[model samples]
Target: MTDEPRRRGAARTDELLRVTLETAAEVGYAGLNVEAVARRAGVGKHTIYRRWPTMAALLLDALSRVWTTDLDYHDTGDIRADLREQFLRSAPALAAPPIGPVYRAVIAEAQADEALRATLHDRFLRTVEESTLARIKRAQEAGELVSGVDLTFPAEVLCGTLYYRHLLSTRAVDETAVDALLDMFMAAYGT
Candidate 1:
């Protein structure tokens, strides 16, 4: 009997998250607000506030649900090939609708909001960077990459370059660009 309330709460949370994404897609982050999301979700504002203290937090959670899979790298015994596969797989999400715009919006807002910036790094960027670093470390252990090297910069560059292109430049992060990045990484780090 007690489980019923918890299940309902979980279901309501999922519904709210879905509505939040839809609202962000419809209006962009600048137009998103707690009251608006609550109204759109057919719930009161307190419902959202109870789950997330701020709209940024809610948006982060919504984005996290959809963006998790691409952050993970496959261990195919070849670091270059595995990274290439993961980067290619993730490129579309950064360039396409739904996730891309909301992500860009959050990043832009974070530039002015220190709290949001910290939360963004803590919640999202750290996960991506950690995953990339872990993959590289594994490759190093297996002798696919150079030994005794500080891989942190390489990992950051690998992820940061794509984000820079996606968020700042007019250029596309197509296959050629990804290959070029991988080629550089291999030239620098590969054994």
Candidate 2:
């Protein structure tokens, strides 16, 4: 009997997350609200409020569910190739709908909201940066990169440049751009 309620709750949570993504895709972050989600989800406002304290929190959870790409690099022995592969795989998703637009919206809102900014960093940016740093560190240990250097800045630059181009510039994060970025990184850090 208890299992039935738990299963239903899980299903409802999934439905809510789906509706949240759909709503965000249609109306964007500025147009999104708890009431809107509740209406679209066919649930009372209290239901959503019980799960998430705020719209940003709900959006964050929704984004997390959809953006489930491993973000971890494959140890293909070649650092440049590994980085390139990861970037090429992820760049398209970042440039497309659902994940892309929703993420951009959160980022825009984060600019004005300190708490959201911190939450966004804690939930998303930090994960990407850490994964990137771990990959770079592995390469350095293998002597593919320069020795005894702090890779944190380079990792941020790599990830941040792509994000900046995607969110702030006109450039597409295409294969050519990825190759160019890899070339630059290799030249600067390669042993």
Candidate 3:
């Protein structure tokens, strides 16, 4: 294919992914299907299947496009403040339309699907954790981080708490919650 056709193809794929996430958010992963996504994207089911080859693959693509996996870590030399800011930045993304519900659905699906679990771990979770660990190391080098804490520690504690609030409860993951979460972690690690 020529460059123009290839560019249009990529654009169509992007649209398909956007529609996939939105449909999954609205109807849930359980309810999401190729038919729905194709219909919403205004494309044929063959188009989606041709791109993904499997439902899991399609979901992984959609998530990769929309999931906010990284923090806006500016390294202001205060790990605590930076982490707080990161979580504050994450709050809106968590509560944002499509992302929140889609994440909740995927999380629920991953609990039951081994393929999803492996894919999420391999692709999203590991990538985000490694990036975060690298950021943590930078903070450590600056003598602003707690010694001996692991990288997954923040993911297990802070992100865990935030996700709990996001999916399980009606309580909002607001600024107060973000501050409280940051405080809890800072106290734990003495950061």
Best by lDDT: 2
Q: Which whole-number lDDT from 0 to 100 does residue 2 have in model 1?
A: 44
Per-residue C-alpha lDDT of model 2 across residues 8-38, encoded as one tens digit per residue: 4878999899999999999999999999998
Candidate 1 ranges with C-alpha deviation above 4 Å: 1-7, 68-70
Please write out the lDDT profile of model 1 over residues 1-191, one tens digit for every residue: 34444334878888888899999988888899999999997778988999999999999999887774567899999999999999888889888877888899889989999999999999988888999999999999999999999999999999999999999988999999999999999999988
Off by over 4 Å in 2: 1-7
Candidate 1 Cα deviation (angstroms), residue 104: 0.5
Ranking by TM-score: 2, 1, 3
Q: What TM-score would you give candidate 2 relative to the actual structure?
A: 0.94
lDDT of each: 0.90, 0.92, 0.76
Error of 2 at 41 (Å): 1.0
1 or 3: which has the higher TM-score?
Answer: 1
Better of 2 and 3 by lDDT: 2
- Model 1 scores a C-alpha lDDT of 0.90
lDDT tens per residue, model 3, 16-42: 888888888788989999999988876
lDDT of 2 at 160: 96
Candidate 2: the clashing residue pairs are: none
In model 3, which runs have C-alpha deviations exceeding 4 angstroms? 1-7, 68-72, 148-151
**Model 3, C-alpha of 186: deviation from truth (Å):** 2.1
